[model samples]
Target: MVRGKTEVRRIENAASRQVTFSKRRNGLLKKAYELSVLCDAEVALIVFSSRGKLWEFSSSSRKLLGETLGTCSAAELHELGNQLEESLRQIRKRKQCILAEQIAELREKEKSLLKENKLLHEKFKGGNMLHLNAAEVQSMEVNTQLMIGRPGTL
Candidate 1:
């Protein structure tokens, strides 16, 4: 019997975690070897430590099993990566298309505003010309009064 069962969650105390990992790793390798010998079966196992160290064992011919498993793993990873990349590409294209439509809408609004401004400018110009003609008539009346300074000349 042992003291307590260990949880899979991270161990806050580094020293305890290291001790546990060492014990468990040895036991796992021993079990794999025993199973292979007793059952006359092939076994392959790979483990990576928290520190990135790799551990592996195979009961069958190492060359044959390693080649076969490696090939399959590569193929599966390639397929998964392709799927993820295609999904991302589709998302980006949709975003670009939406932005393009927004830009077109803004351009149409700008054109409408420009046409309204042109009409306002034309109205202002016409009103200003009318005021100028009225001023000219007032000047002409003042000149006529000066020319008829003598009452008999009227």
Candidate 2:
């Protein structure tokens, strides 16, 4: 007969919990060992128990971990650094190009505004002179009427 799947919840009994922990821990360590041996891989596993016990597995000697990492060639590191520097240079160049384009556009706008302002100023100046001439003529008429003894009929 097919058995039903077990629900994976906490085992409330202390003895049952400890037994489960021991079984699972041994199984995990065995898997780790098999994986390292079968695949010829560098593996590290660490487990902690409810009583604060530490268990660990490593495919290689503990001291060899640092040595393995330190085996990278200086030339490789230098090449990586050069690649990063080139990327930064390219980014800066692109930014400068964009800024230069913006500056050119702003200069064009400034020139257009200056030309429009000059034209408006010239138009206003011509109109202002006509207004001033009309004011002068009115003033002269008022003076001449006063000289002839006429007061309010200008």
Could you report the Cα RMSD, in angstroms, for every candidate shown?
26.0, 26.8
Residue pair clashes in candidate 2: none
Residue 97 in model 2: lDDT? 95
Report how far off residue 57 is in candidate 2 (Å): 0.6
What lDDT tens digits, residue by residue, belong to model 1 across residues 1-154? 7778746665779998889888988889888888999999876666668999887777874533235545457676676567557867997999799899879989999999999988888887876744567667577543354453766766
lDDT of each: 0.74, 0.77
Reference-based lDDT, residue 47, model 1:
64
lDDT of 2 by residue, 39-89 (tens): 998676767787788898888744222334355577855664675578679
- In terms of lDDT, model 2 sits at 0.77
Error of 2 at 97 (Å): 48
**Residue 86's lDDT in candidate 2:** 86
Pairs of colliding residues, candidate 1: none
Q: Which candidate number maximizes TM-score?
A: 2
